[model samples]
Target chain A: MKKHNYSAGPCILPQEVFEKSAQAILDFNNSGLSILEISHRSKDFVAVMDEARALVLELLNLEGKGYEVLFLGGGASLEFLMVPYNLMKVNGKAAYLDTGTWASGAIKEAKHFGETVVVASSKPENYNHIPKGYTIPSDADYFHCTSNNTIFGTQMKSFPETNIPLVCDMSSDIFSRVLDFSKFDLIYAGAQKNMGPAGATLVVVKTEILGKTGRTIPSMLDYQQHVSKESMYNTPPVFPVYASLLTLQWLKKLGGIAAIEKINDAKANLLYSEIDRNPLFKGTVAKEDRSNMNVTFLLNDEAHQEKFDSMWKAAGISGLAGHRSVGGYRASMYNALPLESVQVLVDVMQELEKNS
Target chain B: MKKHNYSAGPCILPQEVFEKSAQAILDFNNSGLSILEISHRSKDFVAVMDEARALVLELLNLEGKGYEVLFLGGGASLEFLMVPYNLMKVNGKAAYLDTGTWASGAIKEAKHFGETVVVASSKPENYNHIPKGYTIPSDADYFHCTSNNTIFGTQMKSFPETNIPLVCDMSSDIFSRVLDFSKFDLIYAGAQKNMGPAGATLVVVKTEILGKTGRTIPSMLDYQQHVSKESMYNTPPVFPVYASLLTLQWLKKLGGIAAIEKINDAKANLLYSEIDRNPLFKGTVAKEDRSNMNVTFLLNDEAHQEKFDSMWKAAGISGLAGHRSVGGYRASMYNALPLESVQVLVDVMQELEKNS
Candidate 1:
């Protein structure tokens, strides 16, 4: 069987992204220096920065808006604190939706800066679904949510339509589908998922919402400082930025988000359908709130777990085992995951069913 | 002519490091997925981290000591703040030897946490030397210094024996010499310099000297947090760490720090001797302070600047240009800079002198 990667992150990349990236590493822009050596301030690299930032706005189709695209050093975990630090005024309370591990991590970081109101939480059920029916406070600095819960395989399919700024930790599923970006003030993603490697976090923020926080933030942690310096305040993770750029180019070539969204939906549908139709498999997240990015499931009988694992490993499908924090199986279907890989996985489920 | 790279960083790597890294990126340990795709938490990658950490101690001959090696996300700039956060607890005073832009940046970052005393500063003379004779405050928690100044091309040939903890930013000149590391309580280097790439920081800290700071620090910004977790409180930068591991293996194969230090000494001596002997060029820093890592010089005649630049460019030497803030020529002679490249540059200088 062909090798497939389902490793939640530092996960997967389109084969083309890898090919083009490897070529550039040896010799970037045909310059004598490898892409590895070129200065971020050099014209070739500056053009890369421009194109990357432009593509981010373009991909979201927010070309006319005042959103500043920032590629920063620390990953989304940094943004977990940064979002509140940048948006929360002195003693300001922010409303947070506690969906899973990452969302709670973000809430923990936010509490360091100001009061955090956990408007809704799914902890009682171990975060099987995005919490609903909790009123969002307009007076709170912003309403924070995790667009997709990577660990628990839950997604906030419908965001609350409120005037309050909707801030999201969209680390795992940012570029996987078309986002109604106008509905949110800030959206940040760690590049490891759907974008590139782990060094850079891509932040899309409205310029108007910044500079209101009263905290004296460190330059590295401050979003406004990055904006004023145009993300050139310091040496960036150059290769990852270039890889993200290449992946975006791949996305653009593959007909942008709308086209890719259909393909992703089809891939997720195939696997979810297989789980629904099969007697031995059952998804962990509630059916309505299941994530297309991370499709998690469990065996009907625990005795078959080892058998399924061995068969899948032998067939060359990797990263299919679920996070130990939430065990069973999780096949992360990020944008780079090919439909064929899912087909292989689906075929394995069918094979197991037939054997049984 | 062979190409030479003197970039401050994402700088030169030995041809061997590049060859090995390029191959690994294309087909990592025959794992089918790129090394970039593997999670840092994976067994394969955990081995990469283990070997890299072990190699650091092995090459430095710093094993079984007070030092603890850490590969972290933020560059040495992050360590600027982190150092004081962990160790600066005595009377709110942290003394700094302001050697250059980077060392001064550290002092600035430290001020946020405690009272920072610039015990000595070389700035008025454009950071041409490490200042001397300013007393280290016995009551100060730690005295910080940059081992080798990257911009102005000066080095502290002998570290100050301090009653207080000695913190050094060894970014540009690490792996270029055999050091009595026992003198340093903390040494940090951004890996873009001598190690591998720009995203990771190699921090060597005395483990016993932490957690005394009464102030609360953001978990991400605290050194104790990283030490306790072994640099995996969250996902670390996997690719850079692995690439650094490969580079360290290459360093070990080149016969570790002792063997490489001999070559480094020869390379620095040859270039500095030519600078002293040549009629067309004049060395900038005082003889006692000139850095072995970066050789800074100016043309004897200001009009010879363009000719000198054209000559180097024609010979394919890149990033030989000094930082704009400090103009003239700065040939950064990191360990990866082959002696032949330096010879070519020396020959070019001689040829220019002959023409003059």
Candidate 2:
């Protein structure tokens, strides 16, 4: 069966990326050495690291614009702590808009370093929508927000333009759309969602914004050290970086982020239209705030739950189950997901309605 | 030509483990989802996590011995900081043994968290031997040491029997030999060498020894949180963990660490014998403290450098060039390296002698 993978993270990558990565694991660049075993400092693997860092900037249209990209280990969860450790200073305050679980996580870590103010939060309504009308305090060291919420399936349609240094965690929706690259002072994403695998976290930081945090930062968590060493201050997560490079290559070959956004929009629209039209289902988040990457929905009639799950399983669907926090189905339409897969899901929804 | 990989870390894995891990990356356990895409919370990957953790304890004979195993990201470099963060309290002191680069790295990080005492060091002799007769301070929070110095090619043949907690960075020599697991309160090994790949760090900590630091450890660095969550405090490096599980399975199938130790010893003996006998080469580390995993040597005469380098390259040897700091050669013989490969390297040395 051809499986339609909708996993929230460690999520689907382009099949070509998968094939190429697998081949590299056997014989990377005809070196007769597995990518799994080659030294990160080796010329071939170093080229991979260089290409991955370069492509991240190129795809974001931020090339040579003073934005440095670092491929680091520990995923976005660690980034939650590292961001504040490196940027938030002693006695300084940072503003955070808590849209979902990840945002709250970031806020929690930021508080450990200094003062953090939650300007607004959607947690009051179970995080079903992106919080709006939040005012960034001029005194805040930086303003942080999660661009997309994977668990609740809400995405910010518009970002706040502020003089305060803007930081965004784009873990779930990075590379799935085109956005202004120059506005944010810093952006980070775990590659598992739209980029590549789970080990490497992609960090794009404006070099000027770093080293201002008066507090001493641990070497491993310091952005300045990582950027200065080009993400090789220590042995990096070599295989994940290589896999991300291959995925970035695939994204570039497919015309970069701009081209993927159109397909992503179509996939989101196709599945959302069925949810609105079918009597058996309803969309989870507010219509305008719906995530183009993760489409979440719930069955209107609880009795049809088992039947609907079986139907999707029979259709070779995988990872459609929603998070425990939000009990429903979530179809994660990352950049690599085909529109035909969304059509198949829409057909399953229509079939469920007809059966009822 | 088949490559003989001796690159220290992101180093060699068993061929069977490689095949299985590569296949899983395509379609993990017939779930029709790539291992790269599967959720860490999924039953299949959870099993991989559980089995890998269990095997660590099993191989070390520490199962049900009040120890918990965690698979984390950022490799040993991150652990260099984390070890002190979670264990060293503010105003407290920790004792350290400065063996080589990684130990010195660990010492540098530990100093940021609290006062760190270098109880002993081998740096005076260019780290050519593991320091002996060092007494650890009982007043210290913990005594830290690197079990194997990868760059200097020195291994500790004995461990301190002290009342103070002992923490070891066994990045290079883990799973290559049997050790007294109960004597140490904490043991960490980066999975790139003798384990799997270059992403996850394996931490085995005695549960009762945590939470005494009195400082708030970041959740990501806190061992308690990782133990409670079973190493899924966040989306772990899933692919690396899975690959590690496959390697552990391979290790277990080959009669665990004890059996591999014999082979590792044989391979080291075979290579070191040639290094000692060949007039053109001489071992760098002291004979008594020379590592069984990494055998460091230098050309007796600098004139033979190009000839020796080309000879190894022609014999399909990779990663034989030593670390720049050492300026010689390092042949890392991990568990997966066959004795036959060492013999091949030995033959190359003999051929160099004949050519001279």
Number of the predicted model whose lDDT against the real structure is largest: 2
Q: Score the docking of each candidate (DockQ).
A: 0.56, 0.82
- Write model 1 residue lDDT over B86-156, tens digit each, in one string: 88884578888998998888887887776998888989999987787778889888888888998899998
Candidate 1 Cα RMSD after full superposition onto the native fold (Å): 1.5
lDDT per residue, candidate 1, A206-226, as tens digits?
989998877776666678878
lDDT of 2 by residue, B1-356 (tens): 66888887779899987788888878888888888888888899999999999999999999899999999999899989999988997889999999999999999999898899999998989999988898888999999999999898999999988898899999899888888888999999999998898999999999998999999877888899999998899999988898999899999999998999999889988988888888999999899998999999999899988988898899899999899999899998889989988988999999989999
lDDT of 1 at A159: 89
Full-model lDDT, candidate 1: 0.85
Interface-residue RMSD per candidate?
A: 1.9, 1.0
Question: What is the TM-score, restricted to chain A, for candidate 1?
Answer: 0.98
Per-residue lDDT of model 2, residues A107-175, tens digit only? 888878889999999898999998788789998889999999999999999999899889999999998
Best by TM-score: 2
Q: Residue A89 CA error for candidate 1 (Å)?
A: 1.9
Docking class of 2: high
